[model samples]
Target: MNIVVVGGGLAGAHAVQELREQGYPGDITLLGEERHLPYERPPLSKGLLLGTEEVQSIFVHDQEWYADQQVDLRVGTSVTALDLDRGRVHVGDHPIAYDRLLLATGAEPRRLPILDALEVPVLCLRTLDDATALKSHLAGRVLIVGAGWIGLEVAAAARRAGADVTVLDTAALPLLAVLGVELAALFADLHREHGVDLRLETSVVEADGSTVTLSDGTRLNPDVVVAGIGATPRDTLAARAGLATGNGVLVDARLRTLDPHVYAAGDVANHDHPTLGRLRVEHWDNAIEQGKHAARAMLGDDQPYDRLPYFFTDQYDLGMEYVGHVGPDGYDEVVVRGDRERRILTAFWVRNDRVVAGMHLNDWDAMDSIRQVVGSPRSQAQETTARP
Candidate 1:
């Protein structure tokens, strides 16, 4: 069987790798828009921006591995269209037929209109090339919009590099919608203590060159401006092809689209998770595991992909690991353990008196305990030693 995987990011790369490891002796073609081989993106904002990680360390596998595996790795290629009826995808005018196809197209950063209208370039951290460009401008003053994950990580990197960092957000606190005001307060305090000029309930009203006007009538001339607002899935190919799409390409629990021959993983797939309802995860762990899961599904595995959503981040001295799903207004109360003032704590999101999600900051050996608490009945979780 011939398999074609689009998007040369972490998901696509892993999907191809899994197929080969599963002993599928078939034709595999991996298409990537970027010129570089498939690479992990987490370091783009963390270690790469901090100048602690080498560029070569980010790649999934070397060119030799692809050649040895007999996988056709095509970089600097774009899938112009998906012809589901013909079981093929178009690269410009050329059509590549496939018995099975995977769309790990990932996502693109949401662009801001004010930044787009400016004469000077407003930076974003989505690709490796983006991180390379932003690293040079980390000195002097850096103004960042959005206090989400990307924005906060960038602020941490900039401050560590000796730049005066200012973060603006429309929400009352960073990650307010995801973590709620309770946990969001921790992040707000973390950044502020690190000397970040965090402006909440603020937005850019106008901009020209490097000068920006805020909603509160404050003007500042920053050396660099960045937008970490968030991202939207790149599901245009799937949508135009008549595949079901909502926030992303709609897929079943097994990561298979309506068409059995077509599948999607990573940030571009809005999976119908069994217990968590519908979720579109855009984290590094999801990309890796979902890709591998989709590969097994392609090989006729009947198991549903039901792993809990997991993500980790490092900012300044605090490192955190979060597991399970907790949407806005999803949980009733947050149970805290350890000392919040010491910055080492584990917090559990409880809904109906049951733990639905949990996270830990600077608590290294609590992941196994966290996984036990999340997705468990309160009585069952209480039996674990790591109870909140």
Candidate 2:
């Protein structure tokens, strides 16, 4: 059987590797729009932006490895259309037929509508080219729009690079969407302690050249501006092809789309999760794990992709990790270990005596236990917290 995987991001690359490892000896084609080899994206904002690692080191595998796996790797090729009935994908002037196809077309950064008015260069660290440009543009003062993970990460990197970093967010606290108010407030303090001038509950009204005007009528001039508001899943391809789509391309628990022959994984897929219901995760771990699961399902070994979602962000010497969905309704019980003042603690979200979600800050040991609790159907109320 011939399989074609579109988009050479983490999910697409992992799917190709997993398919080969699963002993699928048929023709496999990996198509990438980028001219460079498939590389890790997380580091683009962290290590690469900080100049700690070389760009070439981020690749999952070298060119020689692709040849060894006998997978046809097509770089710099854009998939124009997907002919579902014919089982063919159009790439510019060429077309490739496949028995099965995996759509892993990740996400793109949400650009500012007033980007054209900005006089100074605004950096976005989504791709290799973005990182390269942002790295070169780093200067005296760096203004970061949005206080999300990507924005905070870039702020951390730019701060480390000797740039006076300022982060602005419309929410009351940074990461409020994910960590709730209490936890997000602590995160806000962490950034402030690290010299990040974080402006909360603030909106960017406009940008003129090097100056950004706030909704409150405050203006700040910076050498560079980086916007990491968030990402929108690249679902146009799937939506255009008549596939089910909501916030992202809708897929079943097995990672198969409405079309049996077509499947999706990674950031672009809004999977019907076993526990959480429907979710479209953009984390690195989810992309890799889901890609493997989709490949396994494609090989007739159907298995539900129900792994606990986990993600981490490095900011100012703190390793912050989170597991499960921290819904917006707030947690019933919050358990804390260590001191939030010291920036070392693990906050557990309990609902009905069960640990539904957890956020770990500089607490790696608690991750496995937290994962176990999230994975099992154990109630938080069942376990008593021993006083120290």
Candidate 3:
């Protein structure tokens, strides 16, 4: 059976790797738009930006590993069109036939219209190239628009580099939608204490070269500008092929799309989770797990994929690991253990008196305990007593 995977990111690479590991001795082809091999993106903003992590360490596998695995890895190739009816994907009129296909197209950064309209080059953090370019722009004064995870991480990295950092966000606090007011306040304080000029409920109204005007009549000339707003799933190929598409390509519990011959994983798959319903995750853990699940599904596995959403971040002295799902207003109350002032604590998001999600800030050994409480279908009162 000939299998074709589109995407060179973590998910696509892992999916193909899983296929070979599972002892699938059929033809396998992996195509990626980028010239580089499949690489992890988290280091791009953290150690890579800070000049601590080497560029070679970011790749998932060495260049020779692909050849050793007998995988036809094609880099710098774009899948221009998907012909689902013919089971072929066209690369600029060159068609490759496949018996089964996986679309791990990942996502692209959401462009900032103000910067685009002003014809100002604003750096974004999504790929390796972006991070390499941003490292050079991390000096002098850096103005960041958006206080999401990416934006805040960039701010932390810039401040550590001794750059005069100013962060503007329309939300009241960073990660307001993910963490409620109480937890969000912690991040706000963290950045402020690090000497970041964080401006909440503010936005860039106008810009003339390096001088930018804010909504509150504040004008400042910054040496560099960065847009770390968010990203949109790259599902245009699936949508054009008449596959079900929403925020991402709609897939069932097994990562199988409506067409039995095709599947999707990673950031591009909006999975119909058994317990959580339809949702799409853009985290590194999700990409790794979902890619393996998709590979098994393509190999005729019947089990469902229902792993909880997990993500982590490292900003200066603060390191965090969060598991499960809870929107800003999704939880009724947040239960805390340990001291928040000392930055060593584990917080649980309770909904209907049950622990739905949990997170730890600077608490290294709390993940196992957080996972136990979050994975169990127990009451919050009972879970609270079971501390790490």
Candidate 4:
């Protein structure tokens, strides 16, 4: 049996590695769009951009691992079309037949319509090349659009590179749409302390050369601008193959597509969670777990991907680990424990008295205890206000 995994990102690479480790004697082939082997991307804007870590530290595995494990790792080759009926993927001129196919096609950075007209390069950190290009503009004036994780991390890196950094977000608070206002305030505070000119309720109106005019009529001259806006799922191949897609490739609980022969995981897959309903997670932990989960499901295991969504972020001296799911509307109220001033606390979002999601701001020891009762109803004692 031949297994073909598309998009040689962390998820696809882990899927192949897990399949081989689990005693699958089938021939495995992994395809990546980039020349580099499968590498972890989280560090690209953080330690890697800051020059704190080397390139070798970010790779999923060395080049020799593919040959030793009998896995064909094809780099710089793209799978443009998926022929579902014939069980084959169109890779350039040739079509590779597969018994089972895993679509780990990752997401691409979303670009603003104004970027096309701009003479200066407006970057987004998604792949290694994107990071490398953005790295060259370091130590210059950086006008970062969006105040999300990518934007904040890039701002942090740029500041470390001695660049004049200014972050602009249309939201009244940073991460307002995702983490809500209070936590967003905490992150905003962290950046402000680190000498970042954090601008909120700001929108990009026009981009001419290196000058970006804001909606408030404020013109700023930045050597380079980065739009850390979000990502769109790379699901054109799956759609061409007639697979269901919403925000991403829609898959059932087992990470199986409408066609049994095809499966998708990671950022490209909008998985239907047991508790969270249909949601697409674009974090590291989900990619690793879902890839393994999808591979197990393909190998005859029927257990659903029931693990609660988890994500973490680090900026300056602040570190956060958030677990559980927070819906689009967000929770009713936030409860805090410990001290925000001391930077050791846990914040929980209560919806109808049940703790839907919880985040620890510098408190590393509370992860296990927080995970135990994350979905459970919160009591009155746990509703006290604490600092961050």
Worst 10 residues of 4 by lDDT: 379-388
Over 1-388, each residue of candidate 1 has an lDDT whose tens digit, in order, gives 9999998999999999999999999999999999999999999999999999999999999999999999999999999999999998899999999999999999999989887656655899999999999998999989999999999999999999999999999998999988898889999999999999999999999998768999989998888889999999999999999999999999999999999999999999999999988989999999999999998898889899999999999999999999999864488887777778877888888898889998888888999988988977766544544323
| Model 1 poorest ten-residue lDDT run | 379-388
Q: Please give, for residues 1-388, the per-residue lDDT of candidate 3 as tens digits.
A: 9999999999999999999999999999999999999999999889999999999999999989999998999999999999999999899989999999999999999977777644445888999999999998898989999999899899999999999999999999989889889889999999999999999999988887767899999998888889988999999999999999999999999999999999999999999888778899999999999999899999999999999999999998999999998743398888887778878888888887668889888887778888889845546434453223
TM-score for each model = 0.97, 0.95, 0.97, 0.97
Q: List the residue pairs that clash in candidate 3.
A: none
Find the candidate with the highest lDDT and give its number.
1
Clashes of 2: 7
Cα RMSDs, all models = 1.5, 2.0, 1.6, 1.8
**Stretches of model 2 off by over 4 angstroms after superposition:** 328-330, 375-388
State the C-alpha lDDT per candidate: 0.91, 0.85, 0.90, 0.88
- List clashing residue pairs in candidate 2: 119-209, 120-209, 353-379, 353-380, 353-381, 354-379, 354-380
Q: What local lDDT does model 4 show for residue 140?
A: 77
Model 2, range 212-268, lDDT digits (tens) per residue? 899889999888888889999999999999999998999999999999999999999
lDDT accuracy of residue 256 in candidate 4: 93
Considering lDDT, where higher is better, how would the candidates rank from best to worst? 1, 3, 4, 2
Pairs that collide, model 4: 340-387, 340-388
